[model samples]
Target: MPADDFSLRKIAIPAYGPTLLYGLATGAILPVIALSARGLGATVALAALVITLTGVGSLLTNVPATIVTTRFGEKWALVAASAWCALAMVLAASVPVLWVFAVAVFMVGMAGSVFGLARQSYLTEAVPVYFRARALSTLGGVNRIGVFIGPFAAAGAISLFGTAGAYWVGAAAAVGAGILSLQVPDLAVRSPGAGAAVSAPDAGPAPTVRSILRSHARVFRTIGIGVLLIAAVRATRQAVIPLWGQHIGLDPTATALIYGLSGAIDMLIFYPAGKAMDTWGRRSVAVPCMLIMGLGLGLLPLASEATGLLLAALLIGFGNGIGSGIVMTLGADFSPSPGRPQFLGIWRLLADIGTMAGPGILSGVTAAASLSAGIGATAVLGLLGAVVLWTWVPGRKAAVGSITG
Candidate 1:
């Protein structure tokens, strides 16, 4: 638990490589898939359904995939999941029809959820507890590099070879990730606690869906609610920015630049925020960060000019950098099972719900009322999330003093 015991260099590099590659490939391809659907003559609503279908797949498979890791182990689960994802991407690349592409994307989402859950769980188990927060942050930062690059890559590919070509490249990256998954070292599984005997590797009772659900009730409920609120706010920004930019007569390239700039800022800030979490504690960072994010969301309606937009992006990037790091660290801290995949699945499932709902709510509200109303709604939700943390979660001072004294 000593500060020196957490080796950033030792833990981060190996874990980050595959995750970065995976993020890059997925981020690059997703927009292209949406655009491809649009180009193929799909209606706007149908094009949006691609994202919804992917989310549905992830929601359905996430928990089950986590349980699979509990039974088979994280290493193997990751390897299989990555391979399946690679295959799914390849199949998706070949599909000519929009509906078939949607199905393919759904498969990719299911496989991705499994792979991501296993990898995140592996990090929680492999890294030292004291270093876990920073490690998660480092992972997030590294992964953001992929987010930073992927869309640009996809854009370039779309210009040259079209959306299908972009997907082919994504498929290749996924295969590479699968190969990287094979390199992850297997860690020994420990019993949940003193009273519980470690299950036999072969004959151990697989965690029934019922038990996993019951065991994670409180932690999942709290984190799930928090994540939904956070996701709604974040998703509103994502859904609104492009429309706002276009309404204001910004060129497509300028709009793209804004997104890229925000991503770059997020990548830069995520690591420091992660380290701060390690030193300062989760609540110390998370509550204030969410409040800052709320301020940014509230300010978005005022961002008619480039300068205001850039400032809003900075606030959002830094706030999300801190908020995401804390959430991942907390999920690891609260997980009841050593089988990390299942715990991550539980965490992501709840988080994804918010992500899934955010755009719908934002778009609906914006359609019914003014853009200010939509932005105001997000600001209110962010404030509520911050209040929940301040009131319910323990503070950093208490956490540190307990450990130190």
Candidate 2:
């Protein structure tokens, strides 16, 4: 079959249901996580630490997660991960101690890494080159949709019960996601270095983490390093936006409204971005995404008025939307066919490190200088990410078929 004949519906529809549920589950908990910590009688500093544990937990799981993915395929791994997430949510709800709830959230994050890497690995295996971006971008879009709608669902649940009711929403989403995970098509993965996909039921004794790492060293050093910066910029954008809003003296409601609008704009363009990446090139998406986001954040500190802040926020959202699945898309593009899970485990670990550090970078800078200086520093890092992509990441034509792995 022709590569163009690869159906977006086939790649995307399978992921659509499960990812949405996962997104909802996580989203419902995110906004109120700190609140939950405080209600458990934790201090403000401890509550903040509670929120930080997720990224830390994700970092701790690469080895075990790789082992699980190696033994079980992506589909089974996702099901297991989602189920773990549901259990974690239930555990979180049951816990009275702040530390226990923190551990539960951390478990959820670790499970998320497995679930995420599995889906990415499966997509890399199943989707052809031409349709890859669209499929992955649509997955990102679906996730954004869930996040957008989840808070409202939590609001209803909260009104009927309480903040704890949101935990049930999270639990339900994980359960639903696990059930949906069972339905995903198990596309046969090809061996690393193979030109085309194959059944690979006996893909030669499944490779080890050490071997996969040594083989993909160049990619990890080059593209992998670049994505870390991308992740940092993305995380910094999230952290800085709210702080920036407050710096400009916007009310909480206005800040949320502006941010929400930006997110909506971001969600609306994922398909077009995927099309551009697949048809034109990865550079088309990556460069503009980084550049636009960098500029938006840099300009945000200069905006004193509500309208100006809104424009900057909207622009940043547009950039973020364009980059919907750019990281996963790049990972898929670079992955060794048979050992995707292992590579992705390490890949995600590195990226999450950047994400975990982004807030610290901003706070440190702001403490040392001013908010504008902090934002400028973050913006420079974002642009620097764009530069890294332009220099290191392959262009559209060159990117295709460049990696024998």
Candidate 3:
């Protein structure tokens, strides 16, 4: 297809339909993983530990996922990963053994890594630069929309089945996602101006993953640092709000309502954020996102009343909402064609590390000092991310060189 003829609406079903199903599968299962582990006779701490296995699985499988995506192509990778995840969900649902359940959870995480990378790599190739941020941001938005609705579906399923009903729902969604993946077309989209896409089927053999990392070391060391900090800040959003709500003595129901409200606000801003990125520049949104989130976190300790907490939470949510696909958009911005999958693998790994570290940082600080201190520390990371992004994420004239150079 000619680049000019392409529009995001043209491929919406093929591009995002599978993602929504996959997200629903994930969302349905995540809320109940701990409950399932507990039912299988895991201790509280062990059940908690089992939850971490998802992140661990994604961390371990990232680079390998790149190899898989490259070897089989994005469409097949998505299909295989969806099928694998469905089986894993079935195992989780049917298994009475704790260890087996843990293994199934880990497999789901591994599948997630592959599924995530494949879709991201595909979108990076299929969309043009002018529409890139909007495409990716919408991708993020739809995933969030799926997740937002997943728990309600899980609740209905649980009423019909049992505690494992969520797993069954996830399994069904995964199968649906796999079916949808078969419809994604293989497009040969242009790079920035005149270059061919790196991952085109007819292209020559790409560089080894190690060599690609070696070549992109500076990119990783510099802007990659900013990416990590951004992920870390983003990760803390869920934890900080509820923890602070509890600290201030709000009841569980009220706390949940507040959290849901924030999430609702967070879901509403993806398109406007993407439009801002395409119109003004990445920094136009990136810096303000971090700044607002940082300010919100910094203000958390002062929120003694529910109203105060709600306001602070809304601020943080708005900040996060505007940054829905900033990470993926940035990854797409800098990726090289021949090694795009590998580079994105490394990109996702950095993000995963940040995601894990965010909570750890908060916990360590809270344990040693106070909840207020831990939140303050995370707020600092957000500000640091803002500064780093302002320095590295180029404006319009330099946009073409933002990451590719």
Candidate 4:
């Protein structure tokens, strides 16, 4: 395939359409889950616990999702995952009991794990090395766009048909995604011999999951640790912005507006960030991303009003935006083709752990000290992440180049 012929535009619809819908489904349901649990007569703490199960489901399913994708191929796995998510959303909407609703939410998360891995794996194989970062960055950005649109869609549904209407919106989105997944061409069949340069001579037997883990232990320990910290800081930003907005007595509407504005800034930068990575190198973006976020968080506690909060939030958003696909791009760069799915599974598991840990760190610190202290702790982690990335993540020269064979 000519480099020019395989541009992002060529694969835009097939590559990004399902991600948009899947992201929409997830975004629509997230805000309403707690409300639905409360409506089902759960206590505040229980409702919170129910919400946590979504992450738990994703965390537990990471490795297993890779197995499904490896066995079924990306297209079929995506289709199946979308169907599973839609069914889970229906159950979430219809369940009378809180536990069943929680289970349904968990199932939604599990399906998400499968869907996410399938798409990432697909992009890794389908795009050439030279275009990998841009492809994955756009994938991340599209998902963000879907998520950004989701809440408004959910609000309309809620107003028209009550809270349950949100779940139906999610179900509709999932079904849409599944239908689109069918349209994504089978890239595997199209170019079976494309990446032979990187392929090894035939080994006696296919590598098992355990052996793959053992083989890549060095990667999992070094660059993988940076991935964990990156995820942690990112999750902390998501949690801190709203909490601090409220802490400074901003109204919910004002806080939401600031948050939305920040997200707008975030969405605008994904492509440029990706292009820079493809050109300058991953380190060029990754290190600066973490640095800016860390600084933003460190300064967040000084914001006592809406304007200050907006500035701080935008800074954080800018930082996050520039590093949009860093994690997935890194995974693709380091993944060995024969066991790529397995490697990415472990990669995602580390990221998920960091995601869960960020919130826990904030909550734990706030409980013991103060909210400012919690934010400060996360700020420190963000800087630490930058340092780790600088230490472990290789430059573009080391990671990718145009194929000449």
Candidate 5:
């Protein structure tokens, strides 16, 4: 509970181990799946649909998953989610038909929604308020580590065993993560007047899912807007970067390296940024970071070579690293209940929606105009969002000592 006790290695490893594995599997298989879908007689748009469908599934299940966790417990929900994800991965690897694979991906997304909501909610409750930023940073760092490693591993797997083989590896990893989830202790929701020794309240007449949505309307709306902006930024890059890389004569490996290098930079800065958030306040970091992200996105179209691309990657990585912790910390700070899983579900739903829409929208824009135009539009949107955040969100000066309570 001490302020200094929230070091990255100390808090992050335990909370993020299962998540790391999940991310590893997700990141590793993404490129391989897209390429394979195309190779397997699917069109370019159909190949992309695999990714979009997954996000759609996540958006659909986010709220339901949260309700399930609130009714059950975070630990149980996580275990179930992990198991489901593992099963989905197995189906993805084994199924030969494209539609079947799409279904599997969708199920994986649903499982991801549950797992993400539960894991985030658990961290919010388990970590001390003063250390929230550090904890979130640690989580982000580990998640990025998985991203850094997953692609290379997947690429290697593809070379050795082929695309299906890569998916098999992903399946194994998911199952391993599910096994690990069983070991994590269930975090209790903190309640006023209750000592740390108290157990969670027994499940009662559960609120209808609709009631839960209505209850958290304001929080959901704010989170939805922010997540949409973030998603747009990410989507633009995901959709355009590959084409841009091809345009610049970079191979797939080089493309992967760009993302990996960016992830590495992200890992390096995440912890420090988290610490700064706790000390300096969330808004102080988030607003500027968002604008910086916009700048980085805008610069990407101008990059002509490896070095230029790398520089763009670094700027984007650092900017995103700063904002990621702030958003997670804010979610925890503003949750309407100690039942953090429910709130996380709503929060994640918004994010999933943005992610689902981002790639498609960016792709359309690029088709209509150019990659530069798409990236420019995303950058402008990011800048607008940053301005709104600065004006609307509570500032550091107002919340400076608020965590001390």
Candidate 6:
């Protein structure tokens, strides 16, 4: 296959459709999970815990998910994982008890672990080197599109049918994505002699997960800080932006709109960001992405009104949009083929830790000092991340070439 052809026509064209459906499920239910917990008689604190189970669920099962994906290949694993996610949504819709609902959300998270790792591993191998960045970045954008649209779908469902309707929206997305996943080929397990057709070279012995981790310890030690920082700041943006809007005295409706605007801008830049990373280099995208986010967070305290908040939000969104899949793209670059799934499972675990931590960091910092102080802290973290990317992330590009090349 021509290098650009697969990136432009084959992989992305097929992927965005299912991801949109999956995104609907992902996007729709998160906003309402706490409400659903509330209905189940959860305490205010417990409601937060219930909603958080989704990530907790993922963290619990990611390693097993790696083994499962490695055994079944990306296609079957995704199909099964989506089915599992759908079942969890169904349980969440049907159950009366809050604990059951929490279990359902946790299952959704576990399934997410499987689907995410499988998809990343598949993309790492299926697309050629030159096109890999473009493909992964586009995948990131597609997910955002789902997230961007999911809330509206949830709201409409609630507007018409009430809160349980939101769960149904999630169910449909999981089922639809599963069915669509079936139509995509199992690239990893294709027939013998087919490897050459797809340009898959024979890999050496399949390394144990531990051995792979041990071998790449230095790469992880050196590059992993930048990766962890990126994830933390991105999650920080999602949590901080809304809280800051509310802190500045905007009602929930206006806060939602500000966030919506950010999402729109972030979604718009996925392709271009991916293109630049593929064309320029990883650091080209990574550096500015963090710096812009840091700067945006720093400016949030200055926003006393909607226009000011939106402007800062837009800058952060643009920074995040351009980032697309900096972590995953880099993970793909670092993972050797022999044990890619295992390596990615660990890689994603560390990355997910950042996501889980971001909200807590913001919340704690805000409680300790002030919301302004919290945002300032993230700004400093973002700038520090930029410094790390510049100093530690290894792209000394003369022009648009691979750092590892």
* Per-candidate local distance difference test: 0.70, 0.82, 0.88, 0.87, 0.71, 0.80
lDDT of 6 by residue, 220-297 (tens): 665677787888888889888788888888999999999988988999998898889878888899999999999999
What are the C-alpha RMSDs, in order, of all predicted structures? 4.2, 2.5, 2.1, 2.7, 4.0, 3.2
lDDT of 2 by residue, 249-353 (tens): 989899888888898999999999999998998888998999999999989998997898899999999999999999888877766656777778888887887
Model 4: lDDT of residue 306: 91
Residue-level lDDT for 120 in candidate 3 = 90
Which lDDT tens digits does candidate 1 get at residues 1-405? 233554546645457777887887787787776787787678888888886777788888878886768777777777787777777777767767777777788887887788767777777767666667777777767777876677777777667777777787777777777777777766644443221111222345655545555766665566557766776776666766666667667788887777667666767777678777778777777787779888988887788876677677678776776765666677666654533455567778877788787777777787899777877787788899898776655566554212110
lDDT of 5 by residue, 184-236 (tens): 76544344111111123435544454654666566456544765677667656
lDDT of 6: 0.80
Clashes within 3 Å, all models in order: 0, 0, 2, 0, 0, 0
Compute the lDDT for candidate 3: 0.88
Q: 1-405, model 4: which lDDT tens digit per residue? A: 545567667678978999999999999988889999999999999999999888899999999988898888889999999999999999988877887898999999899899988898888878876777888899999999999888888998899989999999999999999999998778644231332224343455675678778877887888889999999999989889999999999999999999989899999999999999889888999999999999999989999999999999999999999999999988877776677778788899999999999989999999999999999999999999999988877776663322201
Give Cα distance to truth, residue 294, candidate 3, Å: 0.6
The candidate, 3 or 5, that scores higher on TM-score is: 3
The reply for model 3, stretches above 4 Å from the true place, is: 188-205, 402-405
Q: Which candidate has the top score in lDDT?
A: 3
lDDT of 5 at 235: 57
Give stretches of model 1 more than 4 Å off. 1-8, 155-160, 191-209, 338-340, 397-405
lDDT of 1 at 361: 75
Between 1 and 5, whose TM-score is larger?
1
- Of the two candidates 2 and 6, the one with more favorable TM-score, higher being better, is 2
- TM per candidate comes to 0.89, 0.94, 0.96, 0.95, 0.87, 0.92
Q: Report lDDT (Cα) of residue 401, candidate 1.
A: 17
- Once fitted onto the true fold, the runs of candidate 2 whose alpha carbons sit more than 4 angstroms away are 1-5, 189-205, 399-405
Q: Which has the better lDDT: candidate 5, or candidate 6?
A: 6
TM-score, structure 6 vs. true: 0.92
User: Model 5's lDDT to the true fold?
Assistant: 0.71
Query: Comparing 3 and 6 by lDDT, which wins?
Result: 3
